[model samples]
Target: MKPRSTLVRILAMATAAGALAWAVTAGNQPSHAATGPVADAGPGYAVEDYGYPNADKILAEKGILLKCGDGYIVLADCASEQNLLRFLARDRADVCFKVTGEKGYLALELESVHGVRTSDVSTTHLEMTAENDRVTYDIPAKTWEGVGESADGREHTLVEIRTTK
Candidate 1:
């Protein structure tokens, strides 16, 4: 019902004011930690995000790469937990890791792993693969379960474990 000419003028004024305010704020120093955009962090600010910290140490000493995980389940030094997932390989006597959350994930290949222990509250899924064969498993709560050895006794490598809530 209002005049179109008057509406146009008001809108134009508002747009100009908003743009001017934006320009002014854009140049001003930020009042808080700039969660928006960083100027530049410079060289050596980069970090490896795919794997756990100090993964190299574990690989060199324990023969486990521990490339990456969802962080719910994680690698702990031996004897860190009352019970932990255990693997027996031809190359090593045992390899192990601890789980922390009700649901979690880990990606690794524990060669010739014959067994694993399960958490009390979470259901576990284990996957293994050989030259041309692949296998999957589900372990119930609080169980020390057999894996590659139990499943036809094949020397399969563990690829991934996905746990869910």
Candidate 2:
């Protein structure tokens, strides 16, 4: 076998170095809005339904149903970081949930996760109220972003939930 040319070796080394740098920089970036401390689901936190739908239509058509020890829990929609934050900030009735927009949008939702299900699938506007439970330092949306978590621990900053109503 002939030895590789000097130019080829140099280009290969440069490519490898660039890739390494990108990986390091990307890995160091923060993904989601600071969830503060994630409360453990605790014991008896059985999940009756926990699956991802392909599209908004599918999710809206076939929502995920979860049955905990307390009662049945239906997840109508779930989003990541900016979107979640936005949904919470605008739609959630409870004002205690607080989040700062930075680096990216905050994830949020107004879908029915608890209580009785609704027939209306139309998007509704959200309003901010006064309450205190989840709070964190305010950061501009351009300063931070969020990512979704997978079973394998992989993260995605964006996600869409679907279900059948």
Candidate 3:
């Protein structure tokens, strides 16, 4: 049999060789796995812009934008808006909101707002656009109004809603 010292030296040399092989191979991995999309230049990181700060993020994840509102007028659940203040869209389902205080405004552009229901107390105005025309309406307070294709048979989008005392 080989001497004890010779055997110990052989084992240590083997271990060192194995470690060197591993270290060399470890650095050769594809850089894509190491840095992900940061390796790209055109659009480094995807940015979802829904107009509001973090509201864009929320809308990106949930397909909804309800975080946009000052305090007086805000997005509300479709079931909770009394079905009185509701909207219908072409590409999307339904979007709703709750308006409070005497005066408020909402800068919303739900694509294809074919239907609407206005509140009772505050006089409201709707800014809308159809195929080739832009129209504005002085909505009667506490009344249901259809401003889009549902009303004029022209596909329209409710770009903005304004209310006042």
Candidate 4:
């Protein structure tokens, strides 16, 4: 093989280095802003239908059993052992008394799913929020990964608490 000219080698090296740097920077950038007006970021997974007694019958009977946007709301099935209903109820009370007495929406995210059956998981990515004293949740995409009910009886993975303005 013949030795490449110095100019050619330097040019090739510079181009490779520049591409590498761009890739790293782009990968490190935040995919979405954490605290901003809720906007759909193309298509992705998120949590949805997050609230206390997240059922229609239960909500009507209990009369808003838990405050919106409070972390203490039992998002999962109440019959499940991993249910956080009691704990969330207590926390909701505390949060209600501490804040400006304004209603807020609670949001939850199932960050990742593991040791769970694929059949039990929802294919759609969900996003939930409470506004105007009503809980509104939506699925961002028709299909998503990393969401499923645990086979070992563990239901929820990641829970997030947020308030809507």
CA RMSD per model (angstroms):
7.7, 24.0, 12.9, 21.4
* Candidates 1 and 2, the one with greater lDDT: 1
Please report, in order, the local distance difference test score of every candidate based on alpha carbons.
0.75, 0.31, 0.70, 0.35
Can you write out model 4's per-residue Cα lDDT over 27-52, one digit (the tens) per residue?
98877765454555355667654454
- Ranking of predictions according to TM-score: 1, 3, 4, 2
For lDDT, candidate 2 versus 4, the one ahead is 4
What shift in Å separates residue 119 of candidate 4 from its native position after superposition? 81
Worst 10 residues of 3 by lDDT: 62-71
Give candidate 1's error at residue 5 in angstroms: 26
Per-residue lDDT for 63-146 in model 2, tens only? 322112111112323432223322221123411112222111212233322211112221212211113222222223222222
- Which ranges in model 4 have alpha carbons more than 4 Å from their true place? 1-4, 32-165
What TM-score would every model get versus the actual structure?
0.66, 0.18, 0.57, 0.19
Scored by lDDT, model 4 comes in at 0.35
> lDDT (0-100) at residue 103 of candidate 2?
18
Instruction: Please give the TM-score that candidate 4 achieves against the real structure.
Output: 0.19
TM-score of 2: 0.18
lDDT of 2 at 160: 27
Per-residue lDDT tens digits for candidate 3, residues 32-134, read 6556464664556776543455667657764654434445666767776463456767777677767777777666556667767776577778888877788
- lDDT digits (tens) for residues 1-165 of candidate 1: 569988999999999999999999887956666554455554456765667677788778877767688788777655666666656567676666677777788887677778777765667898889768888998886788778866686678888886654
